[model samples]
Target: MEFEMIIMNLLNYSGEARSYSMEAIQFAKDGEVEKAKKSIEEAEQKISLAHKFQTSLIHSEAQGEKLSISLLLIHAEDHLMNAITIKDMATEFVDLYVRMSKISNGGC
Candidate 1:
């Protein structure tokens, strides 16, 4: 498989994960806890796919062959970092919904 393809795939996976995470927060805000949880699960799965690709790169580097970097790889890394950050924040937001649900009795 070409490195460019790998990188593009990584970016797609990362973006998908980030989108799902955001959706989870939206669902929670809309008072859909179950849907929120499902979103999180989907996000987790997406992240796992990204992680697998990341591990592949790391493993290749650790084995003493540096993977040649390209603009696509950089773009993918950017997406992966942003996605992870957004996902973390989304998780916190979702947790807050749990507390809010307690106070509002899931009315909102």
Candidate 2:
């Protein structure tokens, strides 16, 4: 695969992950726990795909393949990092919402 295409794939997957994570949090806020969980699972799968692309780039660099640091590559990395951060926060938010629901229902 071309380097630029790999980066674009990573960006696409990361963007999907970010979007799913956001949707998961919104679902949680709306008290749709199952939908939120499903969204999180989908987001995780996308993140895994993105991570595979990232690992390939790292392996290529380790094999002495010199990759040009292009603006698009940097933007792709930003998307990946942002997606990771948002996923983490979304997970926490979902958990908090779940707990709040439980408390409100007198479960705990």
Candidate 3:
């Protein structure tokens, strides 16, 4: 694939992951645990796809390939990082919501 195409894929996957993570958080807030979990799973899948693209670039660079750095690449990287962070935080929020729900339901 062309470098620009790879970058665009990275951006697209990362953006989708971020959206799913946000949806997971919202679902958890709404007390829809299953839907929240499903969203988190979807986010993880997108993150995995994005990471594959990232790893391909890393492997290329390790083998003495020169990659031209561009603003779009930087933006894509930023989106991937933000998506990862949000996904992680969303997982924690989902767990917290589950616990709160249990507590409210007299589960201890």
Candidate 4:
């Protein structure tokens, strides 16, 4: 794939991951446990796709390939980072919600 296309894919996957993470949180808030779990799974898949593209770039650089550093590339990296952060936080939030539900229901 072309460099630009790779970067675009990174952006797309990251954005999708972020969106799914948000959906997970929303589902959890609505007490849809299964849907929340599914959303988190989807988010993870998207993050994995983004990480695959990122690994290719890292390997290329390790092999002495110097890629041009463009503003779009920087933006893409920022998006990926934010998506990862959101996914992490969303997982925590989902867990918290589940715990709260169990507590309210008097479950150990």
Candidate 3 clash pair list? none
What lDDT score belongs to each candidate, Candidate 1 first? 0.87, 0.96, 0.98, 0.95
The order by descending lDDT is: 3, 2, 4, 1
**Which parts of model 4 are misplaced by more than 4 Å?**
none
Better of 2 and 3 by lDDT: 3
lDDT of 3 by residue, 1-108 (tens): 789999999999999999999999999999999999999999999999999999999999999999999999999999999999999999999999999999999996
Global lDDT of model 3: 0.98
Across 1-108, the per-residue lDDT of candidate 2 in tens digits comes to 799999999999999999999999999999999999999999999999999999999999999999999999999999999999999999999999999999999998
What local lDDT score does residue 62 receive in model 4, on the 0 to 100 scale?
A: 96
The candidate maximizing lDDT is: 3
Off by over 4 Å in 3: none
lDDT of 1 by residue, 1-108 (tens): 566777877998999999999999999999898898898888888988998888888888899987888778888999998888888888899889888888777555
Q: Model 1 segments beyond 4 Å from truth? A: 106-108
lDDT of 3 at 48: 100
Q: Could you tell which candidate, 1 or 3, scores higher by lDDT?
A: 3
TM-score of 2: 0.97
Q: In terms of TM-score, how similar is model 4 to the real structure?
A: 0.96
Best model per TM-score: 3
Report how far off residue 11 is in candidate 1 (Å). Answer: 0.6
